[model samples]
Target: MSLAAAPFTSLPTPLPAPERTKTRLLELIKRHGPQTAQDLAYKLEVSVPAARRHLCDLQDGGLIESRTERPGGRGRPQHVFALTDQGEASFPKTYSGLCVDVLRHVQQLFGQGAVMQVFDARSAEIAARLQAEVPLSAPLPVRVQAFVRVLCEMGFDAVLEQDGDTWLVSKRNCPNLTVARQFQELCVSELTMYQTLLGVPMTRETRIACGQSTCLYRIGP
Candidate 1:
């Protein structure tokens, strides 16, 4: 699984040249694992001093940490820099790819019925959790807000909007996009889950899996 670089959280919106270099340094550590300043300097094509300065800054910002290690327990110790949890979050993950592969294997081995069972099981689990966390007994607006919050917590980037009496919940990004693209049954399972959680019939206005900008659900007044 290849790691794609994302904008650094520790840096400002408009990253300066030095900060951009720091971002690259984080990417290097993320892609290649722990590395010494000398190794990073060579990879980055910068002087040792410059690399050390960037490493120092990143360390201070709590993105990377260093520990001393000696090669094969011989010779002097060298400091090795590695990404912290915050640093690891600065890159795009390939979890969806792994999930797609697993689902594909399941379908190939046990057939489509088995795949449907997987989706149904996952949907039931999500429904149970939402039933527990969200106040389904509350008013529609309250339930909608809570549902959107839960979706955001699940990495959906969900938002709730109102157009007169109707309400729309939009998911800006689908975390399971890779899997949904291959097996759209996952989408039907999601829509069913939303209706079950909201206790109201909802219509999908647009679908990300269908190449729309967002997965939009409209709740009638």
Candidate 2:
């Protein structure tokens, strides 16, 4: 046997960037909250009309919905777009579907700590990504906004609101709500990530895994 001819493990073929972008759009809506055509354009680095046309296509396919924003100020009402439930379903979530069964098996073979260790690893990865994107020294609101932006990028539909000394962070969808419901550890890890990323104490008031309409959090609690 020629030791020099080492066996190579095959890697999963990557999806084309264009195809990836289709799903990415769904994720962007899921995490970033609703976005305008202009916002999508900037994110996609495409022309405004092109982005509008693409969003229209997604809308026509029943993957997205466009609603006129309540005018806070200025000229025409901007049309904000968000993912429909169907759109949220189109994103890649192969693990969540079988999370309960998988975790149960893992617990049988190893221990519950193994399942939690898995969640902790995932949370650490997400936290590191967010930390790199948003500095901890930035102002609190900006950090919150940065966290929301990161959530959007990760495919969450996240928004930030301020009331007095508290900042309300809400996510409209959970990519892995099924797994989160089966294993609350996932939820805990995500909350820990949020606390780390935003650098402020937060309390989770609502959880989609718990049948809430949104995952609502109050910062500075």
Candidate 3:
């Protein structure tokens, strides 16, 4: 008998539907990991069978895995699914995770408390640094530019416009504004600190009518 050659196996390829489903599923998994099929279906806004079909595709693609979970008094155990290493790689990169990574590095450099203290010190240091750059006799517009630049450094998209000797500093974007609204006291404090540093007698008022999507700080002389 002649010996037959072994058949070559092809690598798994992700289909378009499976790819789209996997992308969304990975996002959900990153937000809430180790979910059951029913939970994933609800979160993804798809039917249970549809969710299962996508999940099966992802499993075959090596992007996710499932494990059995048994609750008390259950006839059969449920399978909880989560992203594989390959799955996490499919999602967008997050800077918050990088921030934590930096914190870990700082902890290594100094200590855990030192990292905390550094965070505390940063606001004051930032204020002082900006103060040093402001010219005492500069025009109001120039001073406003300096202030907005400092705010931008702190990850706020701030812009300044002058109208009749008054400066309006609008916060166009703030990545943390949604979660930090509860800490509005901190936001006001930082704004006050910058105003003091600039030696500008600008009255500060905030508008929260637009919800967290938009917040405004009206600074006027």
Candidate 4:
């Protein structure tokens, strides 16, 4: 996907420009594989010195590794850079994989109808799993707190907002939405199931702003 078409959380932010640059460099490596400094400079449109500075920074961050390359009759070796496991983590590939993993698991459970039942089932499963990790004897709000924490750990920017007698469980960002549009319904159903499992009476409203571009799940009790 074009950078502009990426999910909201994947969008480049104004803050942390240096870290973002390093991430962009790693993305380039992941996309094009290994490359020398000159290649990176030309692709990124930066001076050789500036590219080297960013490369060094990324190396320091443990996101990339460099190895010496020698041509058949080269007078000197050049350093070629590529992504390391740690570096690859900075990109959305891992999150995309997680999305696929979850969907696969859901498909196994619900068969061809997984698209319909998987979301709610997964949410219920997550709630059950999380209950084991935290003290469950607490009040409803405390339990919801535990649920939100688990959601955040699972890479959802989940938040619970109070609105009078009801609570709104909202996710501002989901990393998998861009590449997994077929599974968008899963997110909605899962969020709905989360509300049900939380023992809160809730109403769900789903809004698709564009064709697989933006999805909003608003759940309120």
Candidate 5:
């Protein structure tokens, strides 16, 4: 199996050395499944002792576990590291199952209109907070920058760009993706919120809930 470590750009910058190594270790195990300490050390280019130390820490933190495996069912035993449930959750996800369950209950109790109202209220609340943080009277580009900043703060992997005369805002990660899949009213509420906040017409080109890689919105003329 290829032991090449994949590039991860989403890790927060300026991570401390030991923490960075541990995080990478988790990523490697997550991507490659169970890996021997020797393999992890080789992949990380760290000494076996160092790798073992990190593994111990992860095990203590309940992120990874080790199991003894014998090569060819007869060779000497070696330990392999695998991610625990906690470790798997360290990665990003599009939606929350708990949130989905709560929404299901809400729908069952109050009907679809109430669900729509929930999203509408949520959109308004988020829009109000963003408006307070990013002045609506500011220039469109400035507001766009603030919008992206606010989205990032709220756990959305959002970016802003200028496409000729138009501005494009793309969200690469959705914090409530699964919820949106079940409640498309969430997407509609989002568009309405953006227009209300920007005070300009906007169009959604693609939706993550609709199977697109990104939720793309086109703003400006």
Candidate 6:
């Protein structure tokens, strides 16, 4: 008997009927990074208003977010919508699992020292990139703002907010919470990173790992 070769696979499987339009729209956005309603309309071969309606429905469901884009020599700034972390969840991912496994193996094979070194090295690299954007000579508040933007762009769901007299820098959602919890060193490195980046008196007001709602840091004298 002759053996057959393995079958080819396609992403996300497929859906039928009314779900098809929404699913296809999401997939188009996912494949093309971010796109405006007009662009999405052209891609989907649907009218611009219809595309906007679909996008509105998706945004209402918390699948995407609208960001204002200032084009060069533009008549007006336009809004481009992109998938939020929640929206991206509809897609497949393997990186997080692989990262945890790799770190665990490193700790087991070498030692906790090696794992700490890994985190430290990673933090150092991140700090360098952040410093380039924020500048070390900038004011503490300015530096905190820059770092918050960087964290959000890196999928940390970070934001800087003012709470009464304090400026609070918080990561609303931790991208690597599981790995950080398991390693613990990751958490220490994160605090050290903030201190090194901001060059000001900062304290952790709350931490997600410790059952707090948000991972908050107080930045000021």
Which one wins on TM-score?
A: 1
Q: Where does candidate 5 clash, by residue pair?
A: none
Q: Candidate 4: what lDDT?
A: 0.69
Residue 217 CA displacement from its true place in model 6, Å: 0.7
Q: Write the per-residue lDDT of candidate 1 for residues 17-71, one digit (tens) a residue.
A: 9988999999899888889999999999999999999999999999999998786
Which candidate, 4 or 5, would have the higher lDDT against the true structure? Answer: 5
Q: Residue-wise lDDT of candidate 6 within 90-186, one digit each (tens)?
A: 8998887788899999999999899989999999998887788878888766777888888889887988788776688888898887786677889
TM-score of each: 0.67, 0.58, 0.42, 0.48, 0.58, 0.60
RMSD of 1: 9.8
- The segments of candidate 6 whose C-alpha lies over 4 angstroms from its true place after superposition are 1-90, 163-166
Q: Better model by lDDT, 2 or 4?
A: 2
Distance (Å) between predicted and true CA of 149, model 4? 2.6
Off by more than 4 A, model 1: 1-17, 31-62, 65-81, 89-93
TM-score of candidate 1 to 2 decimals: 0.67
The lDDT per prediction is 0.90, 0.84, 0.70, 0.69, 0.89, 0.84
Off by over 4 Å in 5: 1-95
Candidate with better lDDT, 1 vs 3: 1
Cα error, candidate 3, residue 10 (Å): 29
Selected candidate, larger TM-score, 3 vs 5: 5
State the lDDT of candidate 2 residue by residue for 6-51, as single tens digits: 7999999999865666666777788888888888788988888877
Give every collision pair in model 1.
none
TM-score of 4: 0.48
In model 6, the worst 10-residue window by lDDT is: 13-22
After the best TM-score superposition of candidate 6, give how far the Cα of residue 141 lies from its true spot, in angstroms: 2.4
* Model 3: lDDT of residue 115: 61
Instruction: Tally clashing residue pairs in candidate 2.
Output: 7
RMSD of each: 9.8, 19.2, 19.5, 10.6, 13.1, 11.8
